[model samples]
Target: MRVSVKVKPGSKKGPLVETDEDGSLIVFLRERAVDGAANEALVKTLAKHFETRSANITIESGHSSRLKRVRIEE
Candidate 1:
């Protein structure tokens, strides 16, 4: 499955995930957007939510942006 995500890094109300009306996902992480920490957290959180391993999720696009495209391989 491929999903679009909007990441909110260093959020106080975070570690939360939700789906937008456009079918994109919104993810809030407590980690800062530094040293790829936010990306790592995104993968970890998505893995847990999708009931898959982190290795199965790949960032397809928007590596340096808040909006990201992730590929979840089965």
Candidate 2:
């Protein structure tokens, strides 16, 4: 499955996930957006949320931006 996500890095409110009215996902990461830390955290968090492994998740776009498109392979 593919999903659109809005990522908030270094957030005190997360790691948390919420769905927007448009059916997109909002993901907050506790890790900072430095040295790819937030990206790694995002993948791990999504894996847990979707009940899958980290390897199953891939960030197809927006690696350096707040908006990301993720592909989850089941």
Candidate 3:
């Protein structure tokens, strides 16, 4: 499955996930967008939330942007 996500990095309001009316996801993360830290955290957090393995998550696009497309192998 593919998901459209807007990531909020280095946020105190983190550890949260919200959905928009467009069916996209808003993910709050504590990790900053530095050296792929936020990306890693995103994968791990989403993995737990989706009840899937972290390895199954892939950032298909927007590797450096806040908005990203993630592919989940389910």
CA lDDT, every model vs. true structure: 0.96, 0.97, 0.96
Q: What is residue 33's positional error in candidate 1, in angstroms? A: 0.3
Off by over 4 Å in 3: none
Q: TM-score: which candidate is best?
A: 2
- Write model 3 residue lDDT over 1-74, tens digit each, in one string: 99999999999999788999999999999999999999999999899999999999999999999999999999
Q: What tens-digit string does per-residue lDDT give for candidate 1 at 1-74?
A: 88999999999978899999999999999999999999999999999999899999999999999999999998
- How many clashes (backbone N, Cα, C below 3 Å) per candidate? 0, 0, 0
Global lDDT for candidate 3? 0.96
lDDT for 35 (candidate 1): 96
Give the runs in model 1 whose Cα sits over 4 Å from its true position: none
RMSD of 1: 0.6
Error of 1 at 60 (Å): 0.7
Give the per-residue Cα lDDT of candidate 1 at 40.
98
lDDT of 1 at 69: 93
Report each candidate's C-alpha RMSD, comma-separated, in the order given. Answer: 0.6, 0.5, 0.6
Residue 50, model 2, lDDT: 97
Clashing pairs in 2: none
